[model samples]
Target: MKPGAVYFMANRKNGAIYTGVTSDLIKRVYQHRNGLVDGFTKDHDCKKLVWFEMFDDLEEARRREVQIKKWKRHWKIKRIEEHNPDWDDLWFDIVK
Candidate 1:
């Protein structure tokens, strides 16, 4: 089975965040960055890939996405900042 990923995008550090699950992380992140996918991320301008977690099981990624979505804003922020204190836009690394 193909691997899947749960990723979070932000407009900036401590800014609006959007969590999503995708089978192709690189493609999905590209779409979000270019505003190709409509809805919350586009509306909120959350194009920065601040955090992501890969899973061999698509179901696991989807479940994690749902759990993170239900989490408080601060908890999410803390999680992101823990691995990515800088909240760097990881798009560059994954893109090329």
Candidate 2:
């Protein structure tokens, strides 16, 4: 089975954030970056991949995504900063 990932995209450091889950992280993130996926990410211009966590089980990833989505904004920001203090675009890291 394909690996699954829970990811966070942001417009900039401490900017609007969009959290999602995908079976193909690279393709999904690419779509968001290029504005192929309509809705929140596109509307908010949250195209920079700032953080992600891979999971062996797609269901687990989905559950995590849902959990994160319900979190308060500050909690979500804290989680992102814990892993990515600088909020660097993680696209390079994933593609490389």
lDDT for model 2, on a 0 to 1 scale? 0.94
Candidate 2 TM-score over all chains jointly: 0.95
Spell out the clash pairs found in candidate 1: none
Alpha carbon deviation, residue 72, candidate 1 (Å)? 0.6
Q: Write the per-residue lDDT of candidate 2 for residues 1-96, one digit (tens) a residue.
A: 567999999999988999999999999999999999999999999989999999999999999999999999999889889999999999999999
Task: Name the lDDT value of residue 61 in candidate 2.
Answer: 95
Cα lDDT of all candidates, in order? 0.93, 0.94
Q: How many residue pairs clash in each candidate?
A: 0, 0
Listed in order, each prediction's TM-score against the native is 0.95, 0.95
Tens-digit lDDT track of model 1 for 1-96: 778999999999999999899999999999999999999999999999999999999988888989998999999999999999999999998878
